[model samples]
Target: MPPMLPPLARGDIEEAADACAAAPLLNCLLREVGEPTGDPGVHRLHAGGRLLRVRGERRPARPEVYADGGWHRLTHPELVKLAAEELRRHTGLSNSELPTEIIDSRDAVAALLAARARATPPAGPYLRSEQSLITGHPHHPAPKARGGGPVTGWLPYAPEAYARFPLELLGVREDTVVEEGDTTALDTFGEAPPGYRLLPAHPWQLDLVGARPEIRDAFADGRLIRLGRTAGPLWPTAAIRTLYAPEDDLFVKFSLDVRITNDIRRLWRHDLLKLRRTDAATASAFGAVPGSAAWLSDRGYRTADFAFEELAVLVRDGLREHVVPGATPLLAAALVEESFDGSPLNGLTDPSAWWTAYLRQVVPPVLDAFARHGVVIEAHLQNALVAIDADGMPVQALFRDAEGVKLLPQVTRAAGWERLVYCLIVNHLMELAALLAERHPGMDPWPAVRRELTRYDTDHGLPEIADLLTSPTVPGKTNLLLRWTGADGADARYVPLPNPLARH
Candidate 1:
């Protein structure tokens, strides 16, 4: 098993949870609303003008707020309160939901920490990496909110808890089956009755939405039947809704009713409708790129007409075929997450070489896809898989998540470019760079990034590259503000963050 937070007493677990939860909240508060106070690791809340001090950079912890002429340490709840007050004043808006989510996120972390102490982490590097993100989405205000549900409801499927279970298969009557693209892979799970088509559902999602009147009616009317789960256990990846089946070497993504990070994780109709086009464009772009980089195609989807979104299952190409033969594909997000026992980043001896190889594998395909095919992929950490050779050097990059891909003609070039810059440079590179810099002090990681971008721009002649290199600020997603304002989940709002590429 990969190393876990040392088994802790209940009090210690809560204390550790406080620190675990505070980092991302502090990051969000500082980025979206707080201003640096010029004192090291100190920031002034822009609205309330309160001074807050924190230690560490990659994952800020041990928050202290200035009051009574001295620093007072804050519990995670206090930190949440301070953030809520600041955001409320900062935006002239009150949000009951966001504050609750912040608290729930902290509580959820506590549960995951405790559960992890008792659970066994997966042995394989890829599965370990996929399940290793305890502090998920380092910038989101409530990265692990879990829909504010009871622990029992989510703990069994949580990746951070190292949970693995069989998918609950259901048989959708053949007459009501609605599918597109190639869904043949799904038939391998189980055989349906003569009149039914096999449909696999996430157990948690089935529990959450199966009781709906429409769904219940279908169940009663013989349109849906409960088929047994897969014989083997499937490992839940960081994206809680997606599970990887080792036996079959497949990834099955199901509609999860819970809200994870920014949006409800249901396979919405709109995205499903466009999945084929977006995925095809992405695959085409990767084919054109002259490297080992690959696109893990979302092969197809299967669902019932009566419960399309709830019963939807997406078939994705697994790593065995796409990854380089001798290399192991690790989740990109896991490399930057708090170090685990088998983490490749933790064992790195040559930071520069590792980073250079990483940049070469990750950066080129993204730029080429945009310039040549007009496909803007969400190349953020969780969606990217970096395969490393025996020496632990990054050799190949595999990008996924067709739902997040944006076609150029569908969105204006300017809008698409902003989204691309936000995902690739800001969300993906910035986090990894910060983690690398933190691990290896005095190592400036930006120059290599700048060089890679410069080389790509030279070849592709993308007009935005020159401006991006010198731009004073790059777009940073405003998750804290977005959540507080109750904005549409798909609507992206960005704040200007100091561009490190400019400095390099």
Candidate 2:
């Protein structure tokens, strides 16, 4: 018998696929894989999430959810389709090896066991106290263990880890906090100056930062670290932040330069917000939406009683039970780090590694949130956060960069021009897909993502995310990396966006 999965609902698999913009293959996994024994071996798959499992010596098989009060046998061909789709989605093989291609239930179960056998508890991402932010790998132990797992600290301020990093490695910090009229700058000391407060940093943030830090430090002491002076990208190039110490338990992202501050404001109020209006309208048609301010509140997952602008908190740590690693335990799932290897997938050829997490979980929620709330959110990768679980399954997604949030011009009071639309569709989605492909190695990934985007379009009325990726040449040069169009708007045929990083 094949071993079981984490007792996932057939529904969850389907739901994940639906959001992934990869439903056909996801649906196939559920149907073909059958019931998850938690044992990986054999099972039956059914649409609408019917699952069945194998029993003892011809033991009457069991049902995860018995529809007619009994287990039902599914055809073998059905299983083929399911597995084929997953294989296609993940590995994208042209033919099955029944020899090389056919993955027997026994082998599948063994693979799961192997993964679990190698399952080491994950460490806390950052150590924190009431005053600082610290960094550590989920697999790496904390500088000092609290108990079994590791103690998490919360700090009032994030120290300067970036300060220690080489100047070429500028730490880009993007976070969410309330904005009143329309402007918020990166924090300097730690807490939001007088007008703002720090917000919660979601795990999905794992993939956000582009310039990788040479070293990660979470100061237990109140000491602050800063990057030594060097040169690479210009300061005002984008929103760069300091550090959020996990040991100290607070994250700080500061921008000493004013240009970084102004750009953030312009991107949000003038660009992102304008896009949100249209998004909110289009998303509502499919039942996905969220309040504009409330959307930013997602990182902290709280509603601001006062205006969002009135509540700017730095990155703060939530209470976590420190499980000291003595025996085996489940660490949070999905801890893959998005780093660039100077590979084709990086911005030079495709997207950076960060977008992989976004494609798998984050973007979908933003779309659904905006649709359900009758409010628009700029879901482009810039405004999105994506995180995953131990097994690499995506779980949490948060949206920030409120200035980017927009109200559809035609549908609401909010109005903006092509830049908003271009950014949301072309700039964001294309970049994310490119990044995801970079991380997975051999996978074309872009096509699988497009497959998923197509699934999204089948349900929601928006253009498949792919439709927006466009090149800048035809429209004349612009600051955006690339440009694309939405399927809903112009009547012209689809055109590919020229990637700023991709050169002839």
Candidate 3:
């Protein structure tokens, strides 16, 4: 059995987990519909008329609400109940399921915290950074929800617990195999019998779909055969479905049945069919951009015809070839969350200089990609990778995940621009800026962001740059409202929030 976590009172563990869970939900509730009540820390829910407040800006904690003539502290379940009541009145729509997910998300965090107490983190800084997102997607209410599964079902594959395991190798009979683009890397994993092609599978995914008739039929008919597991373990990255094999310098993205954050983590067939086109466009766009910035291409994917979406494995370009020499690549989300071990942001003595270097490395590539190539890369925190040199300053920016990439005419320019602003500015820059301001109090990071945008305006001459600089409000994705309304995860809906970068 795995070593047990260090002894802690169960109440203490649950309290920490509740705090972890409440922050994001409160963030969402406050951002979407709650009205500020003069006091900077307090807000009134427009729908339910409940007064809510918390401490801290980046990661709000110690939640309380005005009730029964005094402020009452709320437990995780109580917070969920408040959220459900407010969202129902605000949206005028009832949702029973989202409330459960909010609770499940809190429970999942508790499990992760307990498990992490027992396990050792990976020695490699990169691995440590990838697995450090205990409180993920700061704006999403249920960022840690794991399909409400028991801890045993999902904990072994969780990145938060520093979990690492071998990829399950399989042989797909050539006659029944389906593939596109360059999947040559798959063959290097292991050998297959004659007339069979090598295919690598995430063991967790295989377990999820193993009982299906098609999978069982293939196994019995000799159309599919299990070879063995990989010799080396693959580390699960911040994006749970994607695994990195450090030895081979390779990334394999698999289909997961569990709902993580907003969506069921599956590589749907439609996205797979269009992967090559989207990836090619992004690659070409990056090639023309002038800098050390890189786009990790999703080269191709392979899966059995019978279980296309269920078993699909996408091969993405690894960091080895793209990263600057002697620089370590860390997940931007982890860095923003202050979860990355030995984070450069923590050691910054010169806030302005470090912030400038970050904006220079990250801003230009994203703007150039959109303006020049009509490719609106999903440059969100999770998809963006920042490599820092020995001196602990950002040296390069690398972006990944072709499925999230959107081409210009495919989505109207207006729609694409909204997404770019939301992903790049609101999601990526805002979080980093908040954390920076929190660490170095009274430092306004927005002026530096404004300067970066100003430079982009001078270089690119895009009208949206000017509009963004002066706009009072910028789009913020409504994750709580989206889930409560039962909207598709991919269907993003945004409402305006006060834009910090806007000129006062």
Report the number of the highest-lDDT candidate. 1
Q: Can you write out model 2's per-residue Cα lDDT over 437-475, one digit (the tens) per residue?
A: 444456454554454445665677554233333324211
Tens-place lDDT per residue, model 1, 185-269, is 9999988989899998899998999899989999999999999998889999999999999989999999999888889999999
Tens digits of per-residue lDDT for model 3, 273-378: 9999999999999999999999999999999999999989999999999999999998898886544567887768998899999999999999999998899988
Model 3 residue runs over 4 Å out of place are 1-11
| lDDT (CA) per prediction | 0.90, 0.30, 0.89
Estimate the lDDT of model 1.
0.90
User: What global local distance difference test value does model 2 have?
Assistant: 0.30
Q: Please report how far candidate 2 places residue 35 from its true position, in Å.
A: 52
Task: Quote the RMSD, in angstroms, for model 2.
Answer: 20.5
TM-score of model number 3: 0.97
Question: Which sections of candidate 2 miss by over 4 Å?
Answer: 1-257, 261-360, 370-374, 380-382, 409-425, 435-442, 463-477, 480-504
The clash numbers for all candidates, in the given order, read 0, 120, 0
Ranking by lDDT, best first?
1, 3, 2
Q: Assess the local accuracy of residue 467 in candidate 1 as a C-alpha lDDT between 0 and 100.
A: 97
